[model samples]
Target chain A: MVADTASYHRIVLDSRPAGRPTADNFRLEEVAVPTLEDGEVLVRNHYLSIDPYMLGRMSTGVSYAPSQPLGEVMIGEAVGEIVQSRNKEFPVGDHVVGQLGWQEMALSDGQALRRVDIGAAPMSAHLGVLGMTGVTAWYGMTQICSPVAGSTVVVSAAAGAVGGVAVQLAKAKGCRVVGIAGGSRKCKYVMESLGADACVDYKKHADSAALGRAVGSHAPDGVDAYFDNVNGWMLDGVLPLMNRFGRIALCGMISRYGDTPMQLSAHSYLLISRLRAEGFIVWDHLDLWPQALQELTDLLQSGSLRSGESIAEGIEAAPAACIGLLSGENLGKQLVKLN
Target chain B: MVADTASYHRIVLDSRPAGRPTADNFRLEEVAVPTLEDGEVLVRNHYLSIDPYMLGRMSTGVSYAPSQPLGEVMIGEAVGEIVQSRNKEFPVGDHVVGQLGWQEMALSDGQALRRVDIGAAPMSAHLGVLGMTGVTAWYGMTQICSPVAGSTVVVSAAAGAVGGVAVQLAKAKGCRVVGIAGGSRKCKYVMESLGADACVDYKKHADSAALGRAVGSHAPDGVDAYFDNVNGWMLDGVLPLMNRFGRIALCGMISRYGDTPMQLSAHSYLLISRLRAEGFIVWDHLDLWPQALQELTDLLQSGSLRSGESIAEGIEAAPAACIGLLSGENLGKQLVKLN
Candidate 1:
């Protein structure tokens, strides 16, 4: 008799809806795990990433990163251990990173795969500070903004995955960093826990113009570099207040990610005025990766950098995890695990 | 009886108002010509620049060059003879360049004044090609964009003041210059007369998206550097077709200069998608001006660089001339002559 073997759960994109995403759009399905190919590895996902940028991928629209097609496996990066390996470069029992989909068992090519080092850092951190989040912060602050010592650097979404790392890195470089997060607790975490010079609770600010004024108030020296993750209104304040030749490293626009098509047309002042802003894809700077990784790894090794992971229990909660990610409920890095 | 006190005719901004400038917005007034001071020279107005940039001066907004306040003499550059001089550096009858008012005679400190020998080139040529217009084109194209030989360089407002010089300059540098102009006549002038590599008639080309496709057809290599003068919707089309690492020099945005307030929100797809696009005021590179001026002057002397101008007869025609300049009706540098 044939073996009765199947992974009994899958999160399917149920429908393409308007504006913000809802729990109803994602449907859970029972499915059979596929066999691995000759040159493939089978991975049981240990963690799934929940990023604001994922909200961009969920919608079918034009963006720097192409969105996931409706009814397709929602695209994201994940960390897991290799259950079976047929590729010469990879072996069984290896802790690996791959886009293994929102499922229990999946096949992957050796392409874009890297072994996670539990000795270098914690296992869960591969989804947060040591992974894409850490790299993004490293690249945006150092490469895009390139703040000098004593320059006042401001980062939005301060307590989130990328913001937390950027704040600490900027602090290490002698820059005075200000973070804008959602709550007083997050603000305290940014200032005391992450070494930011100050943090603003944007939710209490009432408007972005007011938030910008508050940021300006904190840095009487004028803002030298603005690391923008949240777009829409708060950016309006910072743009006018940016010092001459000030640089804005635009990593992502989380606020506008889930809005309808019409929201795209309301902000031209970003380009028209005297400000200079640049957006980049991470892979574009592959040559800098080794150096960046070395520097960040050194910082991690010395305990100068700290990280947090909002770990969800299993593969079944991935949909709710995504919803929580978009709503800003998840603190630091949001990750999902399945055994 | 009043010792034949010299009075000169001038245009003054009567009051700041909303929308496109009208004849009534400026008033013709007669003012007493001031005597030269210790470091000043008295210049007789031979020619006055009537540029589209002046349209912005009609408003009270901030700019690289401060705006002229209401009841103040409209500020501009003039190519005039040093009819009177108290400054030992500038002797009378010397052909001088100065920021004299829109008047027959005026007093000015020797700041921004240059005594040019018109035996090599026309006095008005200095005002257009060898002066600010020429310097703007040279700096914006060579220094900012850095178009290499064999790259595709696209220029908008092709047959106008800056466009005319940019075409010749790009061609001289071995770049294939494609121009976007308004009509068949301008297209013919841009290609046949000024020697543009190709010309695109934006008005005849339906939507800007289709226009971009057509322009790309001629420039299969895609755009290398975009010397932008006209912004708004035309800018929308050009943004998508630029090659990776393409440079855009924002010297002027004529489309947005009119009195009408624009709800100018553009999509993320417009500009941020490009790998590199930067904007700067030309004066930021003033330290290199002496070298840039010497190089351009050498080109002008050798007939390698050229210029074109559209001159209006009298001071009364200045308002209509400015309107025509805004509408892209005049090709080359639009100027008003007062003998």
Candidate 2:
């Protein structure tokens, strides 16, 4: 039988992080579980998502997304099973989705949460493949990038959660997909599993233009769409090689996530050259979420696409795994699993 | 009597310019003009427009408008009087608008030339406040920018050909206009004559964030519609200060034209901040050119819009004047006088 007394854990933002976030920026505390209201669920978070956008929220500097406020719960998404429920609409043992944040147990308002169909896929898949990152890759490619069939698609940070899914989606659209990952093994996964036409391991090439040359060899006609998950010197290479009227959907910028804000050269030439570059927040595309969910679900169940989680077990290990993500040490989708 | 034999002058693409264009990049040559054929009009140029985009065509880089074919006459708009005609549509003594380039006289197909009504304004006004530059500024504000009355409108390269007209057009639409130019004299003209609410001298402020700080002093409320001409660090300054959902109509990057191919940094922050930036080619908006001409002409006649022309005498001086434009040596509009 479950214990009557509720226990919950919260990782709070202790201070604004300087450069890459360190363990000191977060404060983990065990508190009494909040009482469920009329429309609330108690989710025992099995997995928590650790994304690059968390880097932007840690600083007050200008970013494509808003900053994370100090003294707040560190923003995140968690996949969990409901152990108790107050309202009939959400019954006990029903799997529920919510802004579970970085918590072991969450008492959430029915808002911003939905019932996850755990039967369709593993419950943890909700944190990666069929969750926000998957939806982000889906909408970013189909809406912003809008690559036509036979077009060349280039994605940076190709082995990460969103970039991995983006490669598969572009391939499904009949696009020639090129991915930029960190090393050989991830590069192999990008090509063999994600269906990327080619993969460029940035670690292997020291030249600033090496990725550009590789993309050119794979896409002789020039790239029609670029999914930017890493924005740094690498953008310099992609700008010159994009075809006229090409589209760029900016999803993340993981390369400059650490240290002093680096001096980044502008690729404004794309706008003048008829290149359409747009940045979108995944939250803004909620209207298309249902569509994104259905499509990704079909891809996963049919075995056409698969997802991998680079999981760090235990709630206390979340901070280190987050540090690992910033350092680009984690592969696939970085997750912190509560054991 | 003026020479009746075929006389020629060229707007030579002498050398690629640097920083802002200077007189050294211009070279003038005299040649024998080809004899006029059937359906052709031999016109003597009375006024030529020296515009910002001309600098773009001279550079060997990716541009929506193709770069100038080296060693050829510079492309530009001109007001010319038909001296001889072989087409029924154009006759001697008719003042027509055409792509006369930067030349003394042009042998035209009579296909591109359109006769202007002298009753509207001084025919020379057609080269300044009524020509393509005028249409470019007008349509960019009215159609693309769509600024409402009291909207904070910001135009870079403010004391320039298109910016001069844009400041007035936006002010006419009841916007509080701010201009970014180079010196005190141009800044005075932009504010005192062009009805701009404020002016920022870019030369004095080397730092873009400082320029934005200066702009903030005049317009306490953030800018709404941004008409971009000189894209570089100046744009970087305006980005952080922009209000939510502000519209940036990407016009031209005059500052980048002269530099040997280098990466330019347009603030990518706008994309994630939900600000809308659209790159527009005036040719793509040609359908609205006639409507633009009418509105600007009425404003000019009403004394609400003002124009400045640095008229260079003789066709040989045309290239030097074109170079002066990029250097910010010319106030208002740069023009060539041939008649």
Candidate 3:
């Protein structure tokens, strides 16, 4: 059932950006498909995930993982179907999700690849809520934030992929969830769709002090936990509003993924309120992925957890999609649909 | 056994400092000592502990505890001899330690008071190594830092009261300890007296970047745990040097206690390294004090734990001593010997 295509298009890292990334940073190249060896399979990519963390991998700086090598396939997660398989475990026509990069096709040895059930959810959902982003939300929220019933939880980037799921999970735990997003439109989605008790539009505030006042008005009782996605000024704004013994789950610092020098002035609140601020990457907690995915799938099927997507058509749109994602231009999960 | 003196001198808060505290902010007034009631005792304070945490209480801003009430006795911990008592628990001439404030004499109802064994250690030791400062160090090191054998542990303000004990405790655990202090003298004390593997003098470095380089040269393998006492530039300097899954026990932020807007630009290192930074107040962990004190007392008596004190002449010198402590002028525990 394999298609007779000789070559596939893939995006490679052309140059590292000095500040914010641009289209010039990526170069799309057409390469011949390799013959599958024994125990290997060829996958036809369906959806490629465009995440903020990819920016960290692109920069030649210290990140949780090593920087993505220049002149190589841009690193990312993807959901695709096995069109040609030499491995019995991954049979032809089976859908799988793994680190498949920004390509139309990927050859894998079945290692680190999870067989996704397309009957339960859409193929693209495997690149989003039912995949790594969802697991990220679960780990940071359940393990780090750990909000209890009636406790107030504040989520930065609350309309983005991980933050959106985190907001829902905290709300499901019977918490008073307050969301901070860039625009009023996303803030509305955070409140209405994600079931957050209140949402603060950070764009409306001039500085962290002003944003803090807006957050304080909504969370009259101080915040018990903070699920931080965009760290910088958002972290500064929420820290002072945290109650004594509050927790801060540092999931991502999307605000500082570029070369921007983000200043954190309200860190003193960490001692003043006796707070616990812990940073974590989802990849480190791989042992919990199975349990996290099970609960997330149940929530999704039960109509409790909801997610939105902003799809950029074709592999060529991957670079601009990522740039848009960093600027908070996307509503939720930003994905590139491959043809 | 009570002395015939009818009146005693005490220092009270005259005004809250806009920035760093001054002598004018305190008022020395003579007041008549109160007669003992049914469950009361009169204590003549011998040594008053001048801690950095008192600055937080003196500020009008939010702190771990309530701000010190103005025009009242300055909040502090004191070691003294009970001159007279109506309670059976605290007899006359028994040496004790409690929150006796900045005064030559204190009247207590036997609440929150602990009797000290002067035979084990000196009377002033009750105000330093064997008292709240020691307990604070114990809780932060054991509960938060929790460094294992062969780990590289870094302690900021390593020559100070709590940091000195923390340095020794980590050393006892068979870990390589690196200390950060103000000058060459304190750095020498950290290495020779506290038994640290290496000590970095932060005063020699112009900026955090320079200090980080000095620390990196000493701890080439990267820091596993950091017991932070001074949390402004010192914390920024050390954060980038932390290994994966490192723990930072935020014991104090003496640098930011005054009117200083500390800008932490290296906070992204928290997410990059997946670090856990937790702030704690020793008062919350009172349940663990008995266990901590038992271990500390054993270590002290066994000569495993060592501490130094810079004692001022009398209660009149308490204000200057505190000011000096904040500036990193005090070599170790700053205390005022009250007469």
Best by DockQ: 3
Candidate 3 structure quality by residue, lDDT tens digits, B171-273: 9999999999988999999999889999998889999899999998999799999999988888999999999999999999877878676888898888889
Q: For candidate 2, lDDT tens digit of each residue in A1-339? A: 223346666788899776778899999887887777777778888888998888777888777557777877788888887877886777788886667888788877667777899999888888888998899999889998988889999999888889999998899888999999898988998998788989998887775587678767888888888998877667767877888678778677676676543345546655665666667787877888999999999999888778877999877788888888888777679998886
Chain B TM-score against the true chain B, each candidate: 0.92, 0.92, 0.96
> In model 2, how large is the Cα lDDT of residue B265?
45
Q: Which lDDT tens digits does candidate 3 get at residues A1-339?
A: 124499899999999987789999999999999999999999999999999988888888777888999999999999999999999999999999999999999999999899999999999888888999999999999999999999999999999999999999998899999999988899999998889999999999999999999999999899999999988988999999999999999999877867576989999888878899999988899899889999999999998888678999998899999999988899889999886
Ranking by DockQ: 3, 2, 1
Q: Could you tell me how far off, in angstroms, the CA of residue A335 lies in candidate 3 after the best superposition? A: 2.0
Q: Single out the weakest 10-residue window by summed lDDT for candidate 3 chain B.
A: B1-10
Question: Residues A1-339, candidate 1, lDDT per residue (tens digit)?
Answer: 112356546577777646677888787777777778889987777777877777766776766667677776767788877877899788988888767677666678888887888788877787778887888899989987899999999999988899899998999899989899998888988898899988888988886678878898899988888888875676666776677667778777776766632222222333344445666666667788777777888998898899866878877799888888777886688888765
Q: Write the per-residue lDDT of candidate 1 for residues B60-156, one digit (tens) a residue.
A: 6655556788887787788888877898888888888777767667687787787777886888887888777887888878876789899998899
Please give each candidate's TM-score.
0.87, 0.89, 0.96
* lDDT leader: 3
Top TM-score model: 3
Q: lDDT score, residue B155, model 3?
A: 93
Once fitted onto the true fold, the runs of candidate 3 whose alpha carbons sit more than 4 angstroms away are A1-4, B1-4
Candidate achieving higher DockQ, 1 or 2: 2
